[model samples]
Target: MSAHNFLGNLQTYTDGLVEEGKTPAVSVAVWKDGQLHLAASGILNVETGVEATTDSIFQIGSITKIMTVSIIMQLVDEGKIDIDMPVRTYLRDFAIADAEASETITVRQLINHTNGMSGDFFPDESRQSGNQIARYLDRINRLPLIHPVGEYYSYSNAAFAVAGRLIEVVTGVSWYNAIEERIYQPLGMSHAISHPMDVIRYRAAIGHFADQTHPEGWKQTEQLYLSMGQAAAGATLTMRAEDLITFGRAHLEGGITQTGERWLSKTSLAQMQVQQVNVPTVSKAFTKGYGLGWGLLHHKQPEDTVYGHGGVTYGQLSMLRVIPKQNICFAILINCSEMGMMTEITNRFLNELASLDYSEAQAKFVNLSSVEQKRFLGTYASLGDGFRIVSEEDHLVAYYEDTVLKTPVERYSLGALEDDFFYGFNRDGSVALELQFKDCQKDGRYSYLFSGGHLRKRVLE
Candidate 1:
């Protein structure tokens, strides 16, 4: 359970994957009481033969939402901004594809993704200044909506960019300075920067696409386009695993800076953890609902709650989870876009530390009732893709192109209802399926909606 042993286990898991040619590089850190536990595996710079280091910076991507959410909450505490007030009330230029929804959208809704905004249309220059971001607000009129504001969960980075611009309008300071003074510097996250354009010369990892023929390989993305939406997610900050641990500790300690600065009141931090909108549509890799800037996960057994955020870009993936009740927080950064790999490694690392057996948890889905078993026996299809799902006795599975089905048909319990659809939980008891079934069809399909424009579909075969 010690930090050293925990990190050693992580190194083994990530290194094993690296040797198998799965991940190029991965960095991990754990924090408790302002202390850091660090570990690294694989190469930081493959060409230079540089081993991954604690300070090796990788794009944290949408994890920048955390800094945005924290600063907004601080403003709320100071009465400079009201969470319920419409976003346009403060920034007159704010507009949405749907005029009515735009008029009603509030600051809290924007941060929690309850705003109707979808997709990234903020003309890459918006991340620079308030005026630049405001100029892009006119484009929202052409965007489309998946659902009405506050009605259903739909992730949108564009919404965050607009939120960031609103922050500048209210604070009269650059979004970068607000985050640095309020969140990063206060938390001692020195290496974390808002713009990748500034850090290109530093020791940072370039993202690579496994499909080399594709245009998104590491070499191609070395010069990613800068955006005015940087506040929403343009920050290409990198940090030592230890520094990230310090960042996690701030949330674990309820918004208290590592040096004892109470950046936001406990009540405001609590609001950040409240499940304002259900994200049942997001992937199993995500959780049940979204708080202000974090994902809300509910754990059974010992009965605990976790609040954190995750980010993914072209070639990197990052996750930060905080079990406040356990006084444990961990962050994982991988220089590969292996879906769920970071989550898998983080879970395995936590298992070793908690000394909790997962056998029972893993085995929970083995047995299936005749009725439950029969329901999965019919043909199923994904909504977006034409792929079909068929049941093989007790196992439900699917296949698309050359990818094969590894494991399917496990025991799952229904979680709460979100917009009339039920989400499923796996043996580890985390929400895994966001599904809805028709009695006539007898076969159900599942879709995971992770932030805006990111959707995954699967048929239960």
Candidate 2:
């Protein structure tokens, strides 16, 4: 289906999310074969009565980690930085709570989120200065590691902030400028601005907190000025939905801008997608892996992989995904974050898109007879207990026990039994699948690697 048609469903999906009190506004874009498509539902600013448009910028939150990682990778490529070297070797002031572990931590471990870092050292608080973050890390590092370095998955904004400092120390320039000059400018993403202090202002979108329980009534996002720690979690970035598509396209094309400038080699981009550790205990059925600053979700369904990052801060949530082989990309941003509406809307649209048979859905599957596809359509069970796939209206849908998780089939793309099993979207619009299904059945069914460790359905029905 053309993006135009796909866009209609996206708007409807997002509109329903807004009506359901998930969020007040959202921005979404789809990029394919170098072409860009954008659509949004709701307002960028509810108080100003400003409707969300293609150009509205968003606080990309942790997604900024990718930018930080990209710059660090560039330094690595230049021999200015070493991935395996202890970070203290470069930033002499760098310290960790575990005196011995601090000496052992490498830049690579930090980039892959294996540094044993947490979201925050304090309870019910967010945002920290570089100095404050450094102090907090010192305190947290003393607390024994839940798992040894490179053995577990613990998302850490502090690790990335340390990375930002490393960049600053090595480049002798502000981390913000290094990113702008190296990544944003070369990619021609003029609208993409980092560091809340930048003078560039025009298309930026202010973030909104819809949750009323907080003392501050739904207000503008706090600026991250004079805060190097912001690089990891709170970097203020503003960009239209269209420009972000370009950034995604670069990854799709293997890390080179459209004009053919070699910013990063294909090898480097591949390195970023490498699973540093197996995140068996996260969301969904498939393994959630880490590659530098991005998240690698290998969905057993549709037999494809998605690489990118998702971010959240205050009332905003953002996501960017690059389907490397398909040369397709999607970006989602919302003005409000209470209740996880941004995530739900994004999942809904992507799930709908996933339901479409890429072979026939992408102007290719139209000829496959719906009857011929029925054998693959029966209610195959998923890895999660009581989760199964059933044929609905000639399409494959996912159900948890009796409750449908994803609606409408997005073409059941089965993979080699050895590689992947049962694929498509479940009712919740999440990428649905049962990875390593045969193995699970043989063992009397254990926990599904996905669904963050839940008993899986083993018997096929």
The 0-to-1 C-alpha lDDT of every candidate, in the order given, reads 0.62, 0.60
Query: Each candidate's TM vs. the true structure?
Result: 0.75, 0.69
Estimate the overall C-alpha local distance difference test score of candidate 1: 0.62
Question: Model 1: how far is 125 from its true place, Å?
Answer: 5.7
Model 2 / residue 418 / CA error / Å: 23
Worst 10 residues of 1 by lDDT: 399-408
lDDT of each residue in 1-461, candidate 1, tens digit only: 76556555765766776777667788778765445677678776555667776677777777788878888888889999998999888888777667788789888888887675654443545234445555656666666554567765556777887778887888998777787778777788777766545675556765654655543222323434335544455445555566667777777777787677786799987898888876554233224668888887765443466777777665677888787777878888877766546656766655665432322222222344445544433333222222233444544433222111111334545433433244455667665544543322424323332322232222344
Misplaced by over 4 Å in model 1 are 1-4, 8-14, 120-132, 211-230, 281-287, 301-303, 355-461
Which portions of model 2 show Cα errors greater than 4 Å? Answer: 1-4, 8-20, 119-147, 211-228, 282-285, 301-303, 356-461
TM for candidate 1 is: 0.75
RMSD of each: 7.2, 11.0
